[model samples]
Target: MSSFKSYFSIIQVLLLFGYTGFFSCGAGAQQMASEVKEVKAPKLLFLNYTISKDTNGTYRATFINKVLTEGRLKDKTQRQPLSDAGDIVCIQYNDKNDVLDRSYIKNPLQPIVEYVNDDGNLEKRQLNLNSAQIAIKLQLQEATSSVRLFLIDASGNASTDLITTSIR
Candidate 1:
């Protein structure tokens, strides 16, 4: 009878603390899951850059075709993709819409010598291709104030909206 009583007492103690322990463990796991999800990369899609000359004599560059994740437009690198014919089309936009000053990003998938403006200008200084290319290249500029980016695919498929960023 004494042993039974002792066992019952132990069970009661465990019941008292079990819920608290379970809740704490669950809370910790929940936090870790959310943190992992937050670090996920944004989806790649075709977007476009729209430049409109405002009445105040300013060219407004806006990015459109946003992926519906919370990670879109976050500080990340964006590199142009290679084409099926071993060619790459480079699209360069300055802090402003001055496309003349754009850099040609080298593509490892192919030897893309012509991946520059028709006027013979290079894009980036040549770097290893990586997953974070787009996020790193697309950024805000203080001189241009606000610039939006659009994703243009290899086949020239694009969305008609703007991904806006404030350079200030």
Candidate 2:
């Protein structure tokens, strides 16, 4: 009877701590989110950085298309897939969509671009010819505060909406 009572007591203690931690963690996350400013895809900005600063204060940037890796945007649930031979454009813009820099990826899957890896090393990478999506890197003159990217297919189907990659 004592062992059974001990087991029940331990379970009760675990449940108490687990539920308490879970609820508190959620509330804390919510509060932190509320404190932060609204931004479009903030995590993406940090991941695929649109800007970088060298040690000499010379800031440079690149539009590395990590999302369009496989050459096509497809959803199994969707009836039609957005993929073809056309172009993908990365447009850097100001707050009011003033175009700052425009980079195009034509014949995207057949590039000999000097890709800068995460370690800041330049590497020669090439995309296969049979790629469905546009795959290339575009070096920018300088980092901008925001970017809007879109793709247009040969069949005249464009990206449904603007892909805003911003740090504002």
RMSD of each: 14.8, 18.6
Candidate 2 lDDT over residue span 50-71, tens digit each:
3333465332334444431212
Clashing pairs in 2: 71-132, 71-133
lDDT, candidate 1, equals 0.42
Quality of model 2 by C-alpha lDDT: 0.51
Give per-model TM-scores.
0.25, 0.30
Q: What's the distance in Å from true for residue 13, model 1?
A: 2.2
Q: Write the per-residue lDDT of candidate 1 for residues 1-168, one digit (tens) a residue.
A: 999999999999999899889999999999998887444454322334333434543323444433222234442333334333212233434554674212223333222243576688866444322222232233322233344443334465433222444433
Model 1 CA lDDT for position 30: 95
Off by over 4 Å in 1: 37-168
Q: Model 2: how far is 119 from its true place, Å? A: 38
lDDT values of the candidates?
0.42, 0.51
Candidate closest to the true structure, highest lDDT: 2
